[model samples]
Target chain A: MHNSSRRGFMGKAFGAVAGVGAVGSLVAMKKTWDPLPSVKAAGFTTLDMSIYPEGKLITEKWRGKPIFILRKTKEMIDSQTESQATRDIVVAGIHYMIAIGLCTHLGCIPAYIPAEKEFHCACHGGQFDWSGQVTKTPPPRGLDIPPFKIEGNKMILGEVGPEFQAMKDSGVTL
Target chain B: MAHFTKATSVKDWLNQRLAVEKIEKVMASEYWIPKNINFLWAMGMILAITFALLLVSGIFLLMYYNPDVNLAFDSVNYTIMREVDFGWLWRHVHGVAASVVFLVIYIHMFTGIYYGSYKKGREMIWLSGMLLFVTFSAEAFSGYMLPWGQMSYWAGMVITNIFSLGGLHMDGLVEWIRGDYVPAQAFLTRFFMLHVFLLPLAIMGLIGLHFAALRIPHVNNQDGEEIDFDAEAKKYLDGDKAGSKVMRFANDFMSKDMMVVGIYLIFFFYLVFYNYGFAMDPVNFDPANGLKTPTHIYPEWYFLWSYEILRPFSINIGLMAFGFAQVIFMLLPWLDRSPNAVPASRRGKFKIWFWLLLVDMIVLTAMGKLPPQGIFSTIGLVAALGFIALWIALPFITMNEKKV
Candidate 1:
């Protein structure tokens, strides 16, 4: 009985030690991202699609901008080609055309309005319709799609939002 | 005449004030303090003393501090590190002491809950304590932003974003609070003023009121025994054995409290001189640019449980749940019960509840730092549910306990 009791006690202690060790390791490993170093990297690289293939998306950092290079999906290209008002749409989701993922009024990410077939400002209520036309007046002009060239299976896109001339003529870069 | 000509010894000077005969007489006199104090009984004075320390040191800070956002960080650094005599020491003391004050306040309130200090005559004290904690937490949060560090900036954004739940346009409110679109110079300045002046003043006044109300009922002693005596004395018309006499404040309470104070001072100095105030994450040291969102935004440790609660649920539920937890705590006196409000008699039940609370708190804290969607969050949800169950069980268990 004494021996059994000793074994029991030892078993419990071992279990506790194991439990603690497991928890410590789990917590240590669970740190998904390191904030300190990223914050310290005073400058970040910005990527432009000019380097990649058509339909390929690459990430580059000019400062902190998240630039993407997506070769137009066949459906997306077809949808934009079909709509005159949205002919300037750079990319299209199944339900809505994205003029530029960037907002026309203020350079914020706009949400696709699937039901309205428009691009809506997630920040403010600025809206653009299927043709990339500014449906809302606060936006001075239609949204501008950054110029991109498709070469074979790859696509190259500029890092800047749009041509200065196009932005001025449209007066939409507000 | 010959003796008078000689210089007085150190002993002679002390002898007159601390005459053994007088000291002996005072020590022998049977003084009545409430005999029924439970563990919860000790925390009230501790908290009060802490609040007083915070107030005095904060006032000293205000004298050297400038409230302008642009100038606030540098000014604080200068005041603590360079400008004033022992300014570094005192500022570090005050900064560290603030963290300690909050830590003590949390423990004190927990003691109150576990021991049922919220019951009977102690209800007002408990309420006042809760109110003090809420105010103190708010002050700490706003003051944190005054440093204009990376953590402060992001912490401000994260907390302010809570107001934007489900299409609520709180931009106006945010701008009003921030004094700009994002946390900017105006907000920092205003927060500095509030932290150094307005909040501390309000806390001091409240502390005074809380203590005054407590004095009227004498410190509640351990167990229900002392409290029962209070009622019996009141009933029998025995003059004030029930805890109405005022002892010499300096000699009786101060001596004991001083020991605690000394120990605390040592610890406080260590943290200030060695650790400095806990550094905000280095990334937050960058200027607050609204364009960049920090990858992870978490509140200070004290607020983690509530923040964790907000993370797992839908926005609407999370918002409601956030306020709900605080409201539940504020209304705790009515929510929980222990027979006659003394812990000794209710130990078995209170112990269970205390352990349950500890578990819940730890689990919630762990959850708060995790991403909202995952197995970890699921575990967090289970723990939260367990917490709710335990909270609801306190009254039921206490009310049904057999008389000792």
Candidate 2:
């Protein structure tokens, strides 16, 4: 009985050690799949807000997604509700609506219609108004506002700032 | 006239070491198949043939196909299709086989359900087959990415985005899965590796398991009659072959399987030559553009039923329904509470359930392809709910079934 019990304990102990080694190896393998440090370093993009002209929507690539920066003309700003005003980012006293260009419905890049001051996703007919709020069905929510910080006349994207955090906390952006 | 004297010395030499004769007898010659089975029983062999075609054609494509995001499109369209000799033919073969293989699998799957092949003794066969289906789906999704087309990029984007867990903000996990914030070079290479190497290995392993599972309980027959396989084989061996209800799996059953395979290949290659356009999406002709998405995006036809389930609801609810659709088929053996392993036609309520499920899936597939507009959206919602309702109703309806 003593010999059999000792053998059982040894077998279990060896099995446990082997299991730990296997788990450690799996963790190491999984770590290799994460975004590399260089990819993470290239995550942030800084753009001079003043360089973009008013009323014209320009698309720039940041972290491989289209970033839509529309310097809101007076007419565009006048069309928003009190709630919509809060979604706009003011940098150097300039009102601008910045959002990740992909449609909220299925991630298609929505085209900005300068005439109507609205974004239209041709893929599914999902429409977003000047403030990046959905003006059509199918898109469950508004165009997602990217994490950004305003400093002087420059906007840095992919960085969490107080303003972005406030919008997130208010459930305005995801 | 003795067997050993007639056999070649090389056969004897190898058989002495390997027990080749015993293995052949065990796996093939002495293995029994019911005589009541139909041409639908040939689907397993047809699926194996299709897989071999995919492997061969994929290897040819891989020789010229570049995995880089910058070069992959041109490498496929310009280099292979335009430059390599008969490359278009090989591509058409691969494309048609990939699409047609799913058709065969569905027929195989539905035939199993119709015959109650997943009854108590054959759960492993069904489970392993389901595993193969899931793996093939992954392989197809990964292979779809290799073309580096508009549909490829956007499909990758939409699918990876699902990992966010219906608004839980699991972007970290999604990004890790894509190897970047979006589908890029690393994403393409990793998916290529999975499509070519990892997934195929898993599929081959699962196929082995599926066949091995079939060996013990043997295949289910059409009438669901339980035959005495050993006694029938004994009858055949005793020169009472005309009285036996079972036949050898080797020369006898294999000859029938080959006849069905020959007819299937004619139909398959007909599509490869004349109707291959159905398999290669026109939207995918445009190179992958991260900045642009096609006007309409959808998965291949095989995945349409489940994809439709993911639409027409709130994000979280739709995802739940989609998850349910994906896993429900695998649980059919458990959900079906019927006592008899008989055909659906004889199973009373299950007969209606079977046909209704098939029609609902076809409706779902059609709705999935159309733009989710006013009427289409309503129909899609109804059909999606109906699918869930049918599966939910399965156990209650089946539990009271009278055994045949």
Candidate 3:
């Protein structure tokens, strides 16, 4: 009886180790050649937002995700939003309201700070101004907002492109 | 129908005849060989022929093979099973010959090591020989990766990671070795050219230098003694043997080396015909997929122990220890302090360590092949430290024994 049990235990142990080995092998083999997937409609759409004069920011989603657009008024544009919050969002000032939905701290989307012109990440007390710069610390960098181009009357926001340098030169930030 | 005319004049016949005679005379007079050559001296010629065979067969195999990650494994299979005529044979020869060449070199090097072949007069020959071995090793390794198989991919991954130890950021170095962020088509092409052209040329040049250096310092005969041709002949036999100018090539070393060369050729031909080249690792015929690690992953037989050594310890020091062991093995000549070159003279100390090192190497190689766990890994760890211990202890042992 003891011999049989021992044999059974040995068999099970071998099976378990072999199973792990097989899984590892499969995982290793799968990574050798990964063909790039085709682009999806999920990535094709762009966000749209309108900012107010105080470098007031608005957040909205274009491609099923939140975006920050900090529209700066002439006043805020001149001062470049001296508050650390606005200082973070002041990227040439094309889109003033920082609409980037991502939480600067842990990647959870932060709630808006309309009154003080800052983004307060609810998950953490991380703060960012109209410019999207992290005011309250802990977040590594400013929120990532999409690029915007003015299509006649509406500001059309989309993925950043090679023209981002010129956009920044023209007082725009993505 | 075209008609050909026969030779019309005696002058035409004489012109052809003397051309043949002149060719023979040049080969006969100065070029044939030294009369005192022996078996230990034959390795250079054998290595040359082995290298030539590898080069020729390697080039032929390359014609139908692809080195790209996507196509490398398949191309090798395609070449063997379908594409080129007798392509499989060529591939086999290339693969088998690679192992054989290393084996031959090991013996050749041991001959040097054991017989004090690298002592005062032939240090340059030894140096060139070492360089030749290094280049040959590199050539073989680069060629191994060209097949783009599962084993090749992982082998490259595990080997290159050794460079990344010691907080040494080799992101750039890794990229350079791979010829890209990943092993790809570019690496294969470069490796093919290196294996076929550059390395072979380097080998040839080193060989020429090796021979030139050897010629300058006349051949060392057996019994670990230099033959004082002038004094010995003068004392022994009315100076007759000494007076005879270095035996002419026609009746001397040429005849002997030719016989040896014939035997070598017979052996080479037998291997080529009977073995049909050599058995390739089946896994190599499958294309590299980074996601897949084969069940039994090891380097070519030459690098097995070191490969095994590097597997156990995840720590950086283990990797360094492994790499150091390999390079240090080649530095044994300088490492030992036995004073005398011959084994018998330094019998007590040298013989023991020589056997220890040999057994140590064998144990390490065996342990390297086992799954890197249990007794095998423990043995590998012990053997790695043992190499270091032997180097340190040999000197101490020699001193104590001398005092006794």
Candidate 4:
């Protein structure tokens, strides 16, 4: 064969070899890629919000339920306080308000609407007021408030403060 | 109009209309590479291998991987790692390759920046790279969620939560992105969808375009000189020249690319086999429990610098600044009013400024890892300011540069 023909043959031969190699590696790789195991959401911890920064609602998990570590403004706190007798969701915040972020109607997480200052569930259109009061229907009850305590800068979730002890001792339910 | 048969060669079939043999000769066999590129140019070859490595490893991991919020960690840490044969190998390869991809890309990026690869007619190529960079971040971020580990869970929630920085009611938007109120099965599913399909496709498309752009513009050389292909070719075709002035793509550059890829694999495999979890977060081994937050939350090392740089400002400002920093790089060519397309190394002041920016990034990354208190924030603000200053100063510094 001439020099040009020899070079053409060589190039074709190289391409063929490379193609085969690619196929072989892909086949080998398939063994590893064949298993389609599900990726579950992992455990997570939000960074400690020392003093639960104002106008912030950080989500935490408590017993598979999302717990919102919400810092209420002074006005919001007063509004809840004025209506405290009719409706209360336990643990009156000296500061941050903590509530299980699940809808009371069905067990679905509700998105917090900052403009409306309410949590609205997408599943059933369940809405709760800023203070966890049931504002809209489908949700039979208000948002379930979690047992939490004010400990320095952090709002300790799923744990009660000394207020719980004092209230329990005094036989306070509301 | 002859129909191709089973035995007909691809070259023969393609050559009928495509002139496959001739085009290959011209583009690959006969096309010339610039001879002056240093070892830094080898990074392009290494990066190509990194993509394949990640794809194969990722596919394997995905096959064994479960995306359910409840079962993600167990399947990855236990089922895939302990139960499946060679599962651990693929997992490690995938894990290590993620970091390796970023490492090479970082080197490639700085190399490009320093070489002024984005200058002049090459703006679109650089822009495509910037798009690739963005897609890589998205792909990596989505991949981070698949394991359903602590880091995956929290990182998913935290990063998506950043979208709330806009003035609009982003709560609904965040929920839509998360597919739930917070990071949950819905969020995991969306991330899986992107990581498995959408973003990968985008990356593949971008890569194709990136290569096309590179080929069309020809590789930028150190001297910022353009190769007059036809002139050189005519001279070489004539007896006037002993050989072609430019390096042949197939015999010269491709061979070096292949050799460099082989060398890169040695290092890549070493890291994969010995330190599989080197790039992964150890905290990610534990299943996600939303109640107990980690002591200190941090982003991946690649993003740690920006995370720190954007740390001081409120969510809105910090978020904006972080985004602007990456987008700024994409706009670098336009931001640079200087007529010079010369390599950044040649521009003495610009080189110093770039190093200062690198130093600033180093400091910010350290801050991102540390507790944002005491001196850290002070240092972070200074570094952040310095970094921003360097980027913003690009046009001013290069204004007087001679247009090559």
Candidate 5:
């Protein structure tokens, strides 16, 4: 190859190498973007709902996240369970929800925006309706419905409820 | 066109519907940049490169960062620094690139001012750039709070309290924003969202408008001479050719921009690795303590000049002046009444006042570091007045000057 062509080829080669290397290194260095796992394992974790009463939300680290265990108000439950969209997550009669707190988009937990009647992700503007369906996306789907059970008005969460399971077997899908 | 419409390929099918080829040619390939433009034109592209770096590194930092007040400091400074793979690299790069972005923006803004790039039909470009700077500050301020450090906490407090100067209570709004009566989890989390998502999106839209406005008139050279594109284009095939006056954006200007960007990355990395302290304040090493304020609270260095202008006078009057001065500066396009597109070298008072205002800004920046006492206070007061006076006097000076 002539000197000029060889130099041009070498320049292009170096540029391409440097460009790919820079981006590759940056991405390789990034930690996994998954939301921190909830530490409270998927089993029967007992919580007395009496103390939490209606309208209080309690948080526990299940699977390494502070997944919300809400003693939801009767009104909130009435409104939510009335719709089929929330059937999988809402407790059968007790007005409780073991809802996933972490945003599906970037894993940052969202705070309940009271005025908006929705959970708004702080890290990104992903909004979930009261029924947990994503009203605004960038979160591809709604907040995850963590499976739970209620016994004697006390919540046994992160496990399938026997009564709920029987109902599901009868083809009653929420 | 047939190649893009082939039935077997999704990429081709979508590209065909989107008209991707035509868009690329119109936006990039066929766009013409002024050929003789110097290195300073590279400032806009450098600002762009630095912003890209900030976005990438910031995303990586966000992966491991927790925005809870009790955990934010430890999560950012300890666990992310010590546990996460290449956490230190991402953290340092993001922090350093923030300062670099501001530096590039300042240079770009002042370069336009010096060359009168904002004059005439490019008013919208200047306005968008000004608004971009405002959004940039909001973006930076919100990010600063994410670490929950001493300066971040105190600065947030001071700036929020500045709203009280109008005498109406601001505590309610402040508490509403913080999600608490104090800087806490809510504040950190909300700021993280704004910094990472909202501001980035807003600034990109503004930059798109800036670029759109820029392409209309093309870039202004050092002389800031008007180009009658109809006359210039008639010299060659209007659609296909770029003359000596205007270079093609695809290869000629893009190659040069890439070369400058490569060189700038070397310096950027040097600061990220070796002189990283310039990007951070020593006070930020301590976690935020609301019970105690730092002895001397100051803004980041990029804001020092404007902060200095607001300092050393009666709090009420100085604050008013600061707001007024910013508005005046942004309105420079209409305010500067010079008939000449290219300013004359020896335009008497106008030329002298231009350099004078530049010197005043440097002096004010220096004063921002000193205690507002003795000579510095007097200098600050004078600098504030003189800076405003220069702008107020510019139109009169321009009208009196002899045309080149």
Candidate 6:
């Protein structure tokens, strides 16, 4: 009886050690899947806000995703609801609508119509107003705003500032 | 027989060490199969041949294909198509087989369902087959991304985004899955690894398991009748073969299976030579652009039925329905509470239920290809809701069935 108990105890101890080694190996392997340092270093993109004309939408690539930058006209700024105005990013005393170009429905790029002042996703017929708020069915939410900070007339994407943090706190952007 | 008479012969010596004769008898020559089954029983052999074709063609394509994001498109379209000898033929064969294999799987699955093959003793066979289906789907999806075309990039984006739980804002998980904010070099290399090495290894192991699971229960037949296999085998051995209801799996059933496979290969190569364009989407011919998306983005036809279910509803509910559609087939052994293991045509209400489910899936597939507008939207909504309704009613509708 005593010998059998000793064998059981030794088997359990060996199993416990092997289990810990396996878990450690898995953790090491999983760490290799993260983005490389060079990729992380290329994350932030800075665009001069003054170069884009008012009411004209321009697409810039930030970390391989399309970022839409549209300097709002006076009429576009005036037409926003009180809720929509809170989502707008104001840079150097000028209101601008900046959002990731991929639609929330299925990640297709939404095209901006200059005359209608709205972005339409042709893949599923989802629409977003000038402030990037959803105005159609299908798309569960509006266009997502990228993390950014404003400095003078330059806007840097992928760096969280207080304004972006406020939007995050209010659940306006993710 | 003559070789076994000599003890020093290689066949006799190896048989003594390996018990080769015993294994051959147990697995093939003495293994019994019902005599009533038809050509549908040959699908398992057909699928194995198609998988072999895919592996050979994929290896030929991999010789010159590059996995880099910057060069992958041209490497496939220019280098492989124009430079390598008979490269287009291999691509055409691989493309058609990938699409045609799913059609054969659906026919195989519905055959199992119609004849009540997932009854008491055969649950593991059904489960392993379903596992193979899911793995093949993952294989096809990963292989689609290797060309790095317009549809490949956008489809990768849409599918990876599903990891972001609808309202929970799990964008971190989505980005982690992609290894970036979007599909790029890292995403391309990871999918390439999955397509070439990891997934194919898993598929080969699962195919072994699928065959192993079939060993004890044996294959079901068209009538779902229970035959006394041992008695029939004994009768045939006693020189009453004309009256026996079973045949040996080796020479008898295998000959029938080979006949079906011959006809199937002729049809398969016809598609590979002439109708291969139907398998390669026109939109995917263009290079990937992060700034642009095709006007109508849709998955390949095999997935369209379930993809349509995700549309026409609110986001969370749509995702829930889609999740249910993917997994409900795995639960068929449990959800069906009928006492009889007979064919669906003789099971009263199950006949109507079976036909309706097939028709609804066809309607969903048709609507999934069209733009969701006007009449298509209404038909899609009704079919999607009807699909959920039918599954919910399954257990109750089947519980009171009279045993045949």
Q: Give the number of the best model, judged by TM-score.
A: 6
Docking class of 1: incorrect
**2 or 3, greater by TM-score:** 2
Alpha-carbon runs more than 4 Å astray in model 3 = A1-174, B1-38, B229-251, B258-261, B264-270, B273-279, B343-346, B394-404
Model 6 agreement with the true structure over B61-178: per-residue lDDT tens digits: 9999999999999999999899999999889999999999999999999989889998868999999999999999999999999889999999999888777867666887877778
Q: B-chain TM-score, every candidate?
A: 0.78, 0.97, 0.80, 0.93, 0.92, 0.97
Q: DockQ of every model listed?
A: 0.02, 0.57, 0.02, 0.05, 0.01, 0.68
- Model 5 lDDT tens row, B1-404: 34434555775666668877788767776676666678888988898888889889988998989888888889988988999989999999998998788888888987777777887788888999998999998998898888899888867765654554422434355445555434555566778888989999999999999898887877887777677654554443355445446666777788998888889999999999999898788888899875444556668888778877766544456567767766777887877787655543545665676678779888888877776666876787788788888888888888766676
Candidate 3, residues B260-375, lDDT tens digits: the string is 76787687667766864343677776777553346556677777666655555433555567667667655655555544545333457666776787788778778776655557
- Displacement of residue A20 (Cα, Å) in model 3 is 57
Question: What is model 1's DockQ versus the real complex?
Answer: 0.02
Query: What TM-score, over all chains together, does every model reach?
Result: 0.62, 0.95, 0.60, 0.71, 0.66, 0.97
Can you rank all candidates by lDDT, best first?
2, 6, 4, 5, 3, 1
Off by over 4 Å in 4: A1-174, B1-14, B166-169, B236-243, B402-404
Best by lDDT: 2
Q: What is the interface RMSD of each candidate, in Å?
A: 12.6, 2.0, 16.2, 12.7, 17.4, 1.4
lDDT of 5 by residue, A62-154 (tens): 433356666666667556544433343444355555566755543446677656667775332466766566776445556655555777767
Error of 2 at A44 (Å): 2.0
1 or 2, which is superior by lDDT? 2
Q: What lDDT does candidate 3 reach at residue B255? A: 65
* Per-residue alpha-carbon lDDT of candidate 2 for residues B311-368, written as tens digits (9 for 90 to 100): 7876678778989998999999999998899999998889999999999999999999
Error of 6 at B260 (Å): 1.1
Q: Which DockQ-derived CAPRI band holds candidate 4?
A: incorrect
Query: Pairs clashing in candidate 6?
Result: none
Q: Give the CAPRI class of candidate 2.
A: medium
